[model samples]
Target: MARGCLLAGARLVDPAAGRDGAFDVRIAGDRVAEVAPSLDPAGAGVVDCRGLVLAPGFVDLHTHLREPGREDEETVESGSRAAALGGYTAVCAMANSEPVADSGAVVEQVWTLGRAAGLVDVFPVGAITVGLAGRALAELGEMAGSAARVGFFSDDGRCLQDSGLMRRALEYARVFDAIVANHAEDSALAEGWQMNEGEVSSVLGLAGLPAEAEEVIVARDLALARLTGARLHVPHVSTAGTVELIRVAKRRGVRVTAEATPHHLTLTEEAARGYDPVFKVAPPLRAREDVEALRAGLADGTIDCVATDHAPHAPEEKDREWDAAPCGMLGLETALAVLLTELVPGHLALARLVEAMSAAPARARALADHGGPVAAGRPANLVVFDPEALWTVDAAGLASRSRNTPFGGRELRGKVVHTIHDGRFTVRDGRVADGKG
Candidate 1:
């Protein structure tokens, strides 16, 4: 479980290296020492990954690690464990904790917690608005310059609805060299909305949140990014219209990037038919057309990367009636399996999946020592998993403190058997391992 380990006979899918073949990857100290057709194990511990896929460790752009408060939902430690088990080596923690990661003090606290956990690299995302009220801006420069050095700012759970405030935030982001990630939901258009506005909502007699709510914000933010010259990131881009907006905006030379959640790419609004609160999520799942569009975007490089949007809510919060339940689902533990099951098999190539899950998101967040090419001089962060392994989801078996996963009881292909972070084994043989101590 230490740095001197060799992974042999695995199909190395390194999109950054543009290679997909059987290669032996060697880890020395904290960097990838060698990668070739054959490597000398010498005195290193060898892991025989004959039928597995070895790729660079993944990076998630959006994750809600409920720390500082609401630890019952998820903490940095628990979320890190879940992410490691799912093959992620770094994750950008969203700024929606109880006290709110609006200040340098709180973000630094979260950053230190991740260091102590010794799992994935947790990037603390500073809040864009004070207390997420959206009217006034938080101390952006202060948070950016603090010990955490937060580079991503967002009010993820709430949208900064004021156009003027949104524009100002973007302008400041340009000055600070940071990203302004929008939740992309227009409050006025989505007021009291329960699910996606479509035939299903009509049949169920439920108030629907029109896809326009998401698209409108995306369109406005694209223009705002263009006008202010700030880097804009759209989180959990739902609906076909929103995807189209991002596609067109990128073509028009807007400095914009977007991410699609696993649920949005795989599941649809049809899951709401049973009135199960587990299916309830903010920016509710859209129709099959939207799901297809999301998959296409990921395939065509229109969508930058796949982020879990790994929101965790307490049992009591999500166990209520559909209308009263909190809108979220656990994701950190199942993201890779879900994507491999849904996106692979002729729809997308293995290299493209590695790009969407690893390289793109890592470069987007500017996380160092991640998104590897599986070669010399790069930090050794990798995942080894059987591409054809099948398993059923079990909530009780998951590593998260909360069990709100909508994927529970679903069978999935692909399973992580080993995860390496910075040349140390955080998970091995489908179990958590600690080499730091």
Candidate 2:
């Protein structure tokens, strides 16, 4: 008797394996036992997955768990639950914590917390500089060799503006074959900026963050990356100029990869017309032309993945006046729904969307156990979604501790039905499964 789970009659869509068809999958313990057109349940527990789309679980290249200091905003446990509900089995937690993840000790603490949660695999990103000050490099080698085995490093909330220091960080990261993800913004150019610089900012009398601010830093970092011959990742690419820069860099064979956020891809500066802080984000939203360029970049494979810069701020922090409010919004819960309702079957194909959210990020971060082919020998990391299921976003109903979602009260399609992590149900029937079901 097979003592495991059987998922029957799912439209298995694994872009990495070039598989898209109806099939039955059997999971025994942590590994997939078999996949065929039909299978006898035998003694395994059966889950009827007819008409659902089963694909590799999503992997977010960028995420902010906000622990070690801002636990009131979000903790590893709550964020992992949110990610499980959102169809993500793994997330790269950013380096911006209370004390900052600049040292091996801090990153290992984060990794330990994620393991305790047991819902998702949380990989902590090491900080590029001590205290994220950009004045000197942090212990990259120490963190890489830590128990966390950190392979990604970034100063996400702030850009590494010092060119010499940036180059040094790149050179050091290359030695370990780790990634250096930069928050591309020239701080001086974007100082005191409230929103994207354009018609909307002018009308609202808010200081605008010019698209050039992002482009300038991106251009500088690309040059340094070319020089160091190191892997560089551009996070939350916002402008058309940045997109073109990355496209050309890839053509020139610079070792670089880029990601665009869901908000940047679907929304625009128009969302800020109401002066709502939820719509405010770092690097801010850009114009319609920029949004179009981001979509085209993702569609053409220039942007490697869709990363959720899922920064969470408490209501008190986020509900302030336009200028006093903090940037960022909740993303883990709404990412898939928003992409499916807004981009799929139009701006992006269904297959590409799955690949961008799953395989691409997994490959970028070198997460071997994630972004699966759903084969017999692979780990059972998968998400079953109802592509046509429609639901409304409710702020209070979210899993994260924060209530700052940009998609609040909006109806969206493509709901997650179940998420299997390590062959156990993390999410079942659209809710977090109980006691590792």
**Over the stretch 1-437, how does candidate 1's per-residue lDDT look in tens digits?**
44778899999998877889999998888899989999888998999999999999999999999998999889999999999999999999999998999999999999999999989999999999999998799999999999889999999999889999989988988887799998888888888888999999999888999999999988999999999989999999888898899899989999988899999989999999999999999989899999999989989988989999898889888999899998898888898888889889667877888888898887777776788778897998999988889999999888899999999999999999998998998999888896422
Q: Which stretches of candidate 1 lie over 4 Å from their true place?
A: 435-437
lDDT of each: 0.90, 0.93
**lDDT (Cα, 0-100) at 151 in candidate 1:** 90
Which numbered prediction scores highest in lDDT against the true structure? 2
lDDT digits (tens) for residues 326-360 of candidate 2: 98988999999999999999999988999999998
For residue 83, model 1's alpha carbon misses the true position, in angstroms, by 0.6
**Model 1, global lDDT:** 0.90
Q: In candidate 1, where is summed lDDT lowest over 10 consecutive residues?
A: 428-437
TM-score, cand. 1: 0.98
Q: Which pairs in model 1 have colliding backbones?
A: none
